[model samples]
Target: MNAIGKTAIGLVFALLLSPARAADINAGKSRAAACMGCHGSAGVSNSGLFPSLAGQSRTYLEAQLKHFRSGERVNATMNAMAKDLKDEEIQNLAAYYAGLPGKSAGGDAKLAAAGKEKAAMCMGCHGNELRGNGQFPKLAGQHPDYIARQLTDFKSGARKAGPMNPLAQSLSEDDIKALAEYAGSLH
Candidate 1:
């Protein structure tokens, strides 16, 4: 190949192969004190209504925070939480949360087992491990409170989604709780 062509190709290859830089975990932890009120110090939330942040993908966390900040994803609490955060702070928070270990679900065994069977319907998109795929949030090891709230939102039409709406509408309250317990038990 010609010298100019080779240089251009080399540059393109370099750009394509560049590794993505992750945010500093230590810096993230230092800045995460304010988040502990809800997310917990180790990222395992005691409150079920708030999602557990531990072990979540940093990319997903950053994206969601950005979305909330931009008003693309609307939640009064999230909006207020995200409003004043700078980009670096968001990245740090994501890094900190992603570094924490996930908690195990401590729900009832019989109910969780029954819920496992019900969760078959969710596996199509959430993955057999319940770790979730693109745009589908991970359910495994998540707080039951968050799961219950989301399920309620789906059923009430408060959370809108073409596919999820139909599925949620079909689920009874018992079914939702069972599935939430099952999902929490996954990891």
Candidate 2:
């Protein structure tokens, strides 16, 4: 290609490939104050019922927030919280939470070991580390409450997806508990 065409293509490629720049941290911090009660001071999450938002991908976080707002991923608390947030606000929040470090919730050693066997079915998509990839949210070190809820949702058909719904349905309640316990133990 000619220099002019190449240059134009390069510019377009750069724009497309560049990481999304986060909004003002201070604004996000201020907005995040309300989130601290459940999500922890830096999005780590204090409650078992809530998933830790720390270190989650901004894209994933924003997408989930949008899902909650749209009722695609229904949760009363999240829906109410996310409904009023503007796109920018959601982006800012996502960026802020993504910047935090993740922590391990620690699980029963026995359960974690057994859970590993139970988790074999999950590894194909969730990764061997349970860190997940692309659209799949990381399951490693996730809250048991959150994992259990997702498993329940999958089993009950509240969270419908081709893979997860069937997988969840196949699992017994004990199996779900074992999987959650196992996932929460991984760093």
Candidate 3:
């Protein structure tokens, strides 16, 4: 390669590795205090009504927060909570939540086994481990009830996830339950 090409490549690498615009985890920690009421401490939820956020992809968290703030995703509480947040605050919160450890919701053996078969459809987007990619939210260790509810919303057109709407519409009620059980049980 030419010297100029080499120099450009080096600069690109440096930029990718640079911490410039990185989320301030300390700031996120304080900002997250207000979120604890429903999302629980460190982004782990204690109730089925909420989904845990610990160890989630930073990008996914950031996207969701932006969605809530923009009124693109329609959850009343999340909309209100995210409305006034600045972009930096959103980045910080996402970083903080993504740094925490995650836990599984443990499931019945039989139920998980049945759900495992159905969960194959999710592998393409959610990944083989169901841990998710940068663009998708991890399904492993999430609350089954929360997963089911989200799936139901997608299926019913109450929620507007791009590809999820059509995909979820194809799922039967039993399929949703089974997939949720299997996914939630994964660590």
What is the lDDT for 2 in model 2? 100
lDDT of 2 by residue, 64-116 (tens): 99999998888888899999899989888888877777888787778778889
For candidate 1, write residues 1-187 as lDDT tens digits: 9999999999999999999676888888987777788888788888886788887877788889998899877889889889888998899888888777787766767778988989989988877778766556678987666787898898999987668888999999999888888888876
Predicted candidate 3 versus true structure: per-residue lDDT over 1-187, tens digit per residue? 9999999999999999998787999999999999999998968787789989998999999999999999998889999999999999999999999999988888767888889999888989998879988989998988888889999999999988789999999999989999999988996
Query: TM-score of predicted model 1?
Result: 0.84
Best by lDDT: 3
Instruction: Give model 3 RMSD, 1 decimal.
Output: 3.6
Number of clashes in every candidate structure?
3, 1, 0
Please give the CA lDDT of all the candidate structures.
0.82, 0.83, 0.91
Each candidate structure's TM-score, on Cα atoms with residue i matched to residue i, is: 0.84, 0.83, 0.89
Candidate 2, residue 135: the lDDT equals 63
Least accurate 10 contiguous residues by lDDT in model 1: 129-138
Of 1 and 2, which scores higher on TM-score?
1
